[model samples]
Target: MRNPSLAPAPGDAVGALPSHWPRAVAWALVAATLVHAVVFIATVANPLVISDAWYFVDVFLRKYVDGQLTLGDFFAKRSAMDHALPFHKLLLLLNYRLFGVDLSVDAWIGFAFAVATLWLFRVALKRATPARDFADWPVQLAWVAMCAVYVSLNTSEIFEWPLLTLAFVALFCCFALYLAAWRALEGARAWPIVVAVFAVTLVSDGGGVIAVIAAALATGLYGLRTGETKPALRAIGAMVLACIAVKLVSWALAPPMQSIPMAGGPHAAAVSLPRLALAMTVPLSSGVLYPMQAQQVFHSFGHAVDMALRLGFIVAHAVFWWQAWRRRPTAAWFLAVATMLLFYGLCAGVLIGRVPQYGEAAFLQPRYIVFYQLHVVALLLMAVCWYVERRPSLDPANTKRVGGAMIAACLGLVLLQAPLDRQAWIRAPYQQAYVQRLAVQMEALADKPEVAPDKCMPQITVCRMPEPVRVRVVVFLRDHHLNVYSPAFRQRHGFEAD
Candidate 1:
């Protein structure tokens, strides 16, 4: 079978049609982006009002207000995400200083980070594409459209999550680091920038350190064939050493953590492989373990349509990997390959840490998918780039059909995601209404009642709320010097019957 890369992209006019195809495609991407925004607005809750959000923000502010926060505390304190992400910590500080515990302002701050995170991925994918075909309008359209679909899959869950932000920050920094390496190869001055981004990634999340290792591996592998291995090796050692230094310091400064009984045997890796694969594809089904396992034909058609988009992505990258190795593996190819390896490393780390931590429920939550989904998306984008670079010899006509099919498949998925995103099975379980209601109740509680407070004066618990959201809600109340009717933690200032 002829490789799609060696053929025409469907509807490729060879510039014969005066850009009939490219304009329409570009408009399609624009429409996708708009629709993505609409879906996000309609379905997602207010950013500042979410599980664990107000609680984390309140903890930081409470410490700061009581003069308990120090520079040392900034590095040492673990937030809801369970690590010291200076990026997130710094954002919290900014929100407090500028907004004075205002939720509206804080929400926008979190949203800004979300936008930056997604944009960085878009930029990284575009950079990974070969420069020759990258200029083609068709490729640009394809690029934006695919990215929009992925981002809109769930608006990054559209809430203020400290850990998620940490992950996104690290992912962005990793992409930034990769771009810096790419520029350095092009004879641009980028090492200083690389060093800065590397440090940022390390502190941002545990994943950041892995990303540093991944970027270095990509550059180092490219060096092996190019015979410029010395510089890459030097950079790799410096970054790894730095990453280790920061993490150790963080560990020393932070409180000691209890060790969990690890379930890391050979079976751990075996168990993780399929979970991660299913997790990676969860976004396609708008965040389900298996959206395509539909029973009814009415719903099955949409599943088929959406799964085709994801399958096309998988097939494209698989072919690109097969073909790229047969030819010269460029720096971008190295990046793509290393990123896939990074995903495996991420999966291994997760299963080892989580399985023992949560036991049977470790792999149940689709939320775990967020940590490595970008790696899958990155591979898909890079695969297309690799294909374009390899088959520059082919005319547009020969290349457009396959390319068009992939792009068409992507555009079709965009339409399907809008409805699925709102209707996701996880949506009902993960809704932010309970947290939102709690936010309002807290505001009203700030003022004392003329009469005595009721027994359930601060009944923060909502029966409808799930455990994850309920726990965070209780934390927020306790942190703000309010009474929580729990045996374990009835606050000091709060009035509770002894």
Candidate 2:
């Protein structure tokens, strides 16, 4: 039989809330999310090609166009060091086939995936709730807190950059896998869902393998604690076997240049162990700390404050975990812990891989903000669960005060993050200007093949293509009328694509 103490108090149910304040706060979070999305779409949603999209088009798409790469080979081939990115490649191919290579579409698609990730969290939150409904104030509070974290500007790269949608896809699959595992532990037939989601997650990014392993471990622990160990063991075994099978196949297809544990493997990271340890704590602090820039975070904050903040976050995490442990194991508690481990493992993997060479800046990359923000969401949810578990002991007036305080804190977080959001807003115009300049440079370079790479491109732009690939890419754009060369694109932005 399940422990009676594991259940939430009846007063904590949605039907028991006494005021309209929780609903109002929830609406405010939703509005904030919407405003963030609208602001992004309005200001920076252009199709000008840049960054990794350049390589994909110049290599994979070019190969397919030249008849050198078959559809099967295109999907199977790995790129960008160790990434097994067949799924991302598939999306790229579909966009090309459906709508001539358009970066704007890719950008919007990425935004869509980001929105979908938020929706997935809501689904997970629903499942974790004791009443399995958002009818209660605590559930509502947790949902809103997650929304605030999800819309953070720190992770704006995932929202704006077209290719980084791969991260969001991987996150979605990881969360789906956890939900499936939860179901299986409850005697539901969910192993197939787990298997399918795991396969998707495995190819989504290099960190997919680590995420799957973490999920399995968390699921197993939750099962063992709740007396459902057999199902948990089965889920873990399935995930482990799947990971091995996929890793072998991918290696056979194309051996990875370097192991993912550390960029150059264990020996490369051995000397940097102390810094790596400090960098690992970045995930905990990065969620809320908005340092000016990736490289400037340590510089701007100074060593003492940076170290203190990271250590403080560590203590905060420990307190929440202890609260979860003291209570009877609930799915909410387990999943919250699981989400934290899932991202924390990824953060550690990244820091271990890059911190030795790149230093603390590696952890502060804008792209990584997505991982840390989700980590913060998990921490917030853990706090919500703790609050729910304690609600029965508080008198009605005390309950009101605590609930009001929580809502105010969420609002305060939004206020604290406003500067970061404003930064994203201000940067959008500059990015648009840069893209326009890059288009002019590409158009000029296409016309003059002998032109030096350095002359036309900005020092800051990633569009500085090599001499060889540079000529081919511009010529391809010129002849095929893609990107800025597209007649339609030209008409819109004063350059033509066919």
Candidate 3:
């Protein structure tokens, strides 16, 4: 296979065809962008508001009311003490300050990030594989479309809050590095661009490790093409500096990680390899449907069947990995696959004890694998596009057919999962309504003279008591076997009753 760097520019127009193909692609991308933005905003804003939005809103409100904000506020007590990275927290804080602590505002903020992510993906794909054949465009577009739609609809806490932003920044930085490498391959001094890209990738997320590796791989490939290693070494140095800087900055801030109490100890052996593989595969087959209780399709088959399904997922990923590597041995493609494998291994270790079990352990919780899924899918898409672009004899019509099939399959899965997502969202209100109603009831009792205001109210006043509050209060107190004026209520300002 010819190096993509050696291929003629897309604008060369060597083939006898209409001159407007490139322009047409540009227009299609624009339309896709608008449609994607609408879907993103609608999904995030309506009945399906993710629970993380509530947590973030609460954190923002607490800080806004208190006149202070810190990374420690985002995690539970134990997690805060462990001092997790604050990059995402900082972004969320900035958004909260500018837009207020409302779900609608946050949804828009998330939507903007989602759009930027798709844009970066398009730009990266264009630079990474600038195909001249009009047939290759559909494959490239299909990859972008799948990523955009799946990511947006599956919008979990990690994707919506911070990781989505991180993914965009990482992709943008990766493209910048790709451009720099491209320049160097063309005999230009582009070290400055390389350094800038390195810095940006580092500050984005720890996962930028993948970007760094890709850069190193690119440098090596370029060196092989030109028989010089200095450029590769320089790229490596930049990546090292970026990683060091991120670590140093994180250590300096060192926000508390002990805020959130963890359910299990730090034992990594609990994560099984087979389980992890199954968890990872569930997303590809079911999109984000596993999170919805009404849509879970794999639970009742017993442990042995679960293990078999997990093995199947591992086999699928293995095939994907082989196909990508065989299609093209580019540094970016290799790095993407390796990083994904490493990430899968780590996640599996945390759940099922080995790299292969990532699927079973991951299940369908959006929070656990949102970023991971995106990276894997993106890399797979990149590999496919690169392969389609390089094959000289491949028919444009055939490429589109295959690309269309992949896109249709992905969209079909997403559509099938939509109803379950909606049901889950509708159920959310009921899940929390009881607690909200109880709080209202407690407020009423605190205002009643018979309940002893001092004993029930404590320091906080239950101002503006609503009618029928006592009725709710009596029902809850009797049902729960609790005193109307429990001492614990007074101790915690009646808020504890709820």
- Candidate that would win on lDDT: 2
lDDT of 2 by residue, 209-247 (tens): 777777787877676566666777887777777777776
Indicate whether candidate 2 or candidate 3 has the larger TM-score: 2
Candidate 3: Cα lDDT at 229: 63
Q: Candidate 1, overall lDDT?
A: 0.50
Report how far off residue 101 is in candidate 1 (Å). Answer: 3.1
Candidate 2 structure lDDT: 0.65
Count of clashes in candidate 3 = 48
Candidate 2: lDDT of 147? 73
TM-score for predicted model 2 compared with the true structure: 0.84
TM-score of each: 0.69, 0.84, 0.59
Q: Candidate 3 lDDT, tens digit per residue, 1-498?
A: 345645553443445553565446645754664575455444433211122332333344345446676543533223421223244455555644553322234445545555565554555454445344333544444454545443544433432333333444444455455555555544567566547554544444444555555556655655665455675566556656756676666556544443222333344434555655445555443323333432343346434444553455467567665565445434334334434543454344334432222325445545544444544454455445455544454476865666666556545544544554454455445534533443444446544523423343221122122234323333333343332344443343223533
Q: Tens-digit lDDT track for model 1 on 42-128? A: 344332333334344444555676787666555544322355565566766675565433333433443455556556555654555
Which ten contiguous residues of candidate 3 have the minimum total lDDT? 457-466
Off by over 4 Å in 2: 1-21, 75-80, 130-138, 254-278, 293-308, 455-466, 492-498
